[model samples]
Target: MRSAVTGTAVILAVGALVTAAMTTATASASPPAGPAKADPPRPVLVDCTWHKNVRPADFILACGDGNSRLIGLHWSQWGPHGATATGVNMVNDCDPYCAAGRFHAYPVTVRLDGPKPWKKDPSVEHYTRMSLTYTGARPDAFKAVMIYPLWD
Candidate 1:
């Protein structure tokens, strides 16, 4: 009887170990937590051709996307050939020329549900023109060539 009980105990222990291993494998094989939020689809540029020396603006813009908060207007002036020109970010409400010569992209986030002209149509339908210039040794004039809106 003693030998029989010991054999049964060993068999039960092995079964428990197998069950635990199977459970772990099943848990790991299952998908992760919740589904990730997919990024918003890109909107077509309806009126981007008319704006000369302006960056191609994005329409489906959001407030807090992985890229930027609001829409950003970028401008740069290169040398004779296709040289690298200084890029500027013109999203601040203050003077556009406040941070001149800084080769950095500026972002301006606007409230879609705020007051004024924006609140009237808070459906991601807004536009603004930004003027920028290169303040380097050889300063070159360039306006916000593109206006990209955020989505998602």
Candidate 2:
């Protein structure tokens, strides 16, 4: 009777150990209660070609008539809030008329700011304001520094 009692006790102890082991394994394998966090998406620039770009070599300021644009862009800083670049602003002289105008290049420092969700796609962000500070020569009717609103 004593041996029988000892055997039953050992069985119960082993069962308890097995149950504890399973509980621990199940807990470790299970996923977290809440949804997993995802990293923030990287911002992009929507160019005149209607494509997303990062540090584009050229960007068009005048999408309608293509009278103004930026070329040879060398971006020094591009972040979530803003971007800074050094480039040349090429504008049409429009001497006789726009169709027969000569394009001129001016050294410029470009700053892109006012980050907002793009109109076409809310998930994507784009710069809404662009500032141009002419370092050397400038356009005929323009100032040394100018700011323009970018299109979505």
> TM-score, each model?
0.25, 0.72
Note each model's CA RMSD in angstroms: 15.0, 6.2
Instruction: Tell me, by lDDT, which candidate is best.
Output: 2
Query: Which tens-of-lDDT digit does each residue in 61-130 have in candidate 1?
Result: 2223222122343324212222122332333222345334233344332212111122333442323322
Model 1 gets an lDDT of: 0.36
Worst 10 residues of 1 by lDDT: 109-118
Please list the residue runs of candidate 1 whose C-alpha ends up more than 4 Å from where it truly belongs after superposition.
35-152
- Tell me the tens digit of each residue's lDDT in model 2 across 19-119: 99999999989986888787656567787878987788999989989999999999998888899999999999888999999999999999988989998
Please report, as a residue range, the 10-residue window in candidate 2 with the lowest summed lDDT: 36-45
| TM-score leader | 2
For every model in order, what is the number of clashing pairs? 14, 0
